[model samples]
Target: MREFVFALEYEPGCNRVADALADHPDARIRSLSLHATDDRLWRVDHATGTSAALEDIEGAFLNGDYYADCLATDDCGATQTTRVLDRTDDTLVLYSTWERTPTCASVPHIARDHLGDGVLFETRHEGRHYTWRIVHSGVGDPAAFFDALEAAVGDCARMEMLRAATTEADAPTGDGTGGASGLAPEQEAALRAAVEHGYYESPREVDVGDLADHLDVPRSTLTYRLRRAEERLAKGYVADERFADAPSTPL
Candidate 1:
């Protein structure tokens, strides 16, 4: 089977939810998933590092002209809505169903229409851009997929293929580095920068404010990015360890 990992950037004006989030200086969508069973059913997870009002995040969905209803909200500020998606102290799971219309132009709809069977592993609002990490399988011709995606999105500049390959090995195992390949570019960079800046030292040499300044981003943005990177790294480490402990097949 062939697997391709792509990082797609969309114009804010082209995607209502992304555009709305971009409008709020402090708001961001941490992670998002669009299930294969139904493109309408979506799972969106928010980052908790920002002090932005919950209403500010909710308003993006409510006014985006996409989601039909707000299903629920937790103490952590995570929300569940019909047309769009939230954060929690412990962790919240929110499910939403989307209705495709001529007016709706979400990235998931475009990918579903073009990439067919692709899995959206991550989505985030970074600065003014919305970056999506998607893994597409059974891709016989990646070039063809790119062509179709560009046609569907109406803007080639917003989309780009980050990595693609056909192989028997799982992603983290392929590079022999225990799944570090799964980390997004920004995430990896953030983690590396944190270590280099002594953020992980016993006596922290750099605070969030200093790191933010060094990264040339808001403190909230830096915090969210670091948190996400750390979580992914930890998960990758655990998966690698589990696989290593598994009984080996007889040669």
Candidate 2:
């Protein structure tokens, strides 16, 4: 297996969404970062670090978190969110959510889908939404990976609205959405900025170019790095689960 990472940036006034995300299923509170905004939510994931045997992949789709939060303002303010899952060694679904709408005109290569061993991430802040997905399959052919990731992000971003992929019958609440340990300074900096900038509003306007500029890297590069941060979060959850099952230390 190879390694890949994905990350996302939210707008200024969409803090509420983040609050809801903290409680999302498939979220793995042990694997996410929580921003202090009522309207925003941010996340990162490393999509390539898993060692699943290629033969283990089955033709199936899994649902992650399902979250909802009230929008004080806006006509279609009320919303629920979730993520999609696939375990194909040939392909992986990095990120999926109903947090908020995307703002980019054209999806960046990093956010596409169908690439092998890639990562995907999404975030909402200040009403502006951001998504990133990457692929680093051992095949070393990121062209198709990039194209697919970009298309996925683009398709997801342009969505008029996002719906929860699950129903209460399946999940009463949902997955946990928290922070992972290995978040880079840059990724954390972006999260901090989203908080400091007041970009966590539901309908807040955000500039992807501006955020890229702030991080001092191309949007694609930043997206990859952010995904790495998310991997750490996801790994943290796995570690915690294992630790939970392990024998406890003597008092």
Candidate 3:
């Protein structure tokens, strides 16, 4: 098995992510390691027993405080947990370390494997600090792995840039002209609070059911409203003005 280790730095004054890690029933502390006076990281073990299914990790990262904690959502729901080392409140450093596990059969060479073509694979971010790696195995060429890695890295970089831009600005100034704003006046008032509540920043932490309760709307209705709001934001705000006048088409 090959191993790779890397570190992610968190901006300062954003440590409330630690609170998200509290009380997650499914949360597990795989392995913890300390590097220096201010650096500590964790290695999450994804392997699970047969009866208990593996849960998908939605988002994980160390906040500005440098400790690794992340929001996770499975097919069932979302939870956030801080997976930090004990006895240290210093800067959190999330690390990734891997080793190959024994399998019943010998691994086949990527070059020789015919199953490599026309195959699609999916990945899930495991531990905090957005530690991403292969979550599933399919027949493939090792060379193809490079393409996937590049795509993931690019996506991460883009997301980080967008997040930084949003943080610097005042809560986004929506004109409220769209009929799809879905949020009630009270909910709209609470919109800015959503980031602090871990909503806007982490979609995985959003509980549609809970949001519906707070908004006094049906869960489905809440979902439709949120979806429409997202659609408008993607099409109107995120897209360039050149595409603004284009009509929507069925995919």
Best by lDDT: 1
The 10-residue segment with the lowest total lDDT in model 2: 53-62
Separate clash counts for every candidate: 4, 62, 9
Each prediction's whole-model lDDT (CA):
0.54, 0.35, 0.30
Q: Write the per-residue lDDT of candidate 1 for residues 14-123, one digit (tens) a residue.
A: 55555455556555556645563333545655533243534455555555544522111112222225433334542223456554434444455555565666555566
**Residue-wise lDDT of candidate 3 within 141-187, one digit each (tens)?**
44454433334233222111001011113325443232244333333
RMSD of each: 8.1, 18.3, 17.7
lDDT of 2 by residue, 1-251 (tens): 33333333322233333322322312211223222122234332222212331111111112212222222223233233434343443433323233343321122222222332233333322122333222233444555654544444332232211111122344334321122334545666665665455445566455546666876756644444444446656787998899999998899
Off by over 4 Å in 1: 1-60, 67-95, 117-133, 140-182, 217-221, 243-251
TM-score of each: 0.53, 0.25, 0.21
Stretches of candidate 2 exceeding 4 Å from the true structure: 1-181, 198-207, 245-251
Ranked by TM-score, the better of candidates 2 and 3 is 2
Error of 1 at 185 (Å): 4.1
Best by TM-score: 1
Residue clash pairs of candidate 3? 11-64, 20-80, 21-81, 21-82, 60-129, 60-130, 61-129, 66-92, 67-92
